[model samples]
Target: MKIRCIAIDDEPWALTLIEKYVKQLPQLELVATFEDAIAGSEFLRKYPVDLLFLDINMPDMNGITLASSLINKPFIVFTTAYKKFAYEGFELEAIDYLLKPFDLDRFQKAVDKVEKAMLAAKLSQKSNDASIFVWSEHQQVKVILSEIMFIESRKDYTCFHLYNKPKLLTLLPLKKTEELLPSQEFVRVHRSYIVPVKEIRKIASRKVVLQSGEELPIGRLYADNVSALVKL
Candidate 1:
């Protein structure tokens, strides 16, 4: 699959160079380019891409601040002239840091890393879409993995909330249910709640909102899990 990408750099030459390098790779698609970080941030809010080529020293808002504020972050490659920002860039889990005057070979290396990461994510998601059997109503029930929205825990039972279907209440505990689901697809946001990562629409103010408009509280202990969700 082609990885959709966008470049944001205050320097026109930097943006042009990134565009040229992106065009050289068949696996990468350049969707847009911006010389203003604010304008690029707006575009990202409306359009989600797989990867980003970002310069760190733009005016008004630098790349580090912009990257940290994104709710849905893309794989980032920080392209800048300054070497001092390398630690900060990697701390944000950037795919690569390309110093100024980088050649096509260096750009290709960063793209290679992005491509590998994307492939791995796709494979993990595929594995999460497999069906599993659950005991409900004294019988074995077949549940489609992809249809699950979230799993809620009751005092002595676990509820499997599916899309457009009745929830299944089993005698199983939430901990046992968590063990059965794929770790990559399901996350425990609270002691009593486990939500599918893909089903999460937004996370704000210690609350996890699902795509269905259902909001669940993010437990104090699980707050870090919610933070990690955005990075995923």
Candidate 2:
């Protein structure tokens, strides 16, 4: 997992320390550097900065206030001279607070936080994004890729019942989606319904009922493949 980070510190030595530490980690990429928090805010608006090495006691605004201003705040690890504000930093949901004159081991702890946060986000995206892209009517539309309960042939076009989306009329045939998607997950239940095996609620002779309680007529031609799926 790669984490794009920005360093915001007023002191030149502090910035140098951050740069050296960031270079040591393969997973971290130093996206931007700022001498002050104000300039850093402008840089962030233009580019997406994932993790921040922020300084608390800047000349004008405090790092805590600046961090709060971001709508989608990055993972913050406060690097400051003041040790008194450590508890307050935690209140901001900072990944870690690194007091000035901290060692390389302490810096690695902050980098670890970024790695963990990124892994969680990737897992969430995989679980939530069940949609797939398709070209339709000279435009592109995303159909719930997993919600494709079944597909049916309509002569030239294949109607994919991705439920709640006006039946996705694709130029490709029923076998196209099946071939593209995992074959182990989908089986041709009937000449019409190429049902996702996971969505099949129950199977009866001649027909298989889907989770939505819709009965799809199973064909004799596809019976052997359907029977193999049920055994697995």
Which sections of candidate 2 miss by over 4 Å? Answer: 130-232
Q: How high is the CA lDDT of each candidate model?
A: 0.92, 0.82
Q: Give the RMSD in angstroms, all C-alphas superposed, for model 1.
A: 9.6
10 residues in a row with least lDDT, candidate 2:
123-132
- Given candidate 1, what's the lDDT at residue 88? 100
> Among these predicted structures, which one has the highest TM-score?
1
Best by lDDT: 1
Query: What's the CA RMSD of model 2 in angstroms?
Result: 9.1
Backbone clash count for every predicted candidate, in the order shown = 0, 0
User: Model 1: which residue pairs collide?
Assistant: none
Q: Which residue segments of model 1 deviate by more than 4 Å?
A: 134-138, 141-232
Query: What C-alpha RMSD separates each model from the true structure?
Result: 9.6, 9.1
lDDT of 1 by residue, 1-232 (tens): 7899999999999998988887888988999999999999999999999999999999999999999989999999999999999999999999999999899999999998998988888886876668888899899998788899899998988999999999899988898888988887889999999998988999989898899999999999999888988887
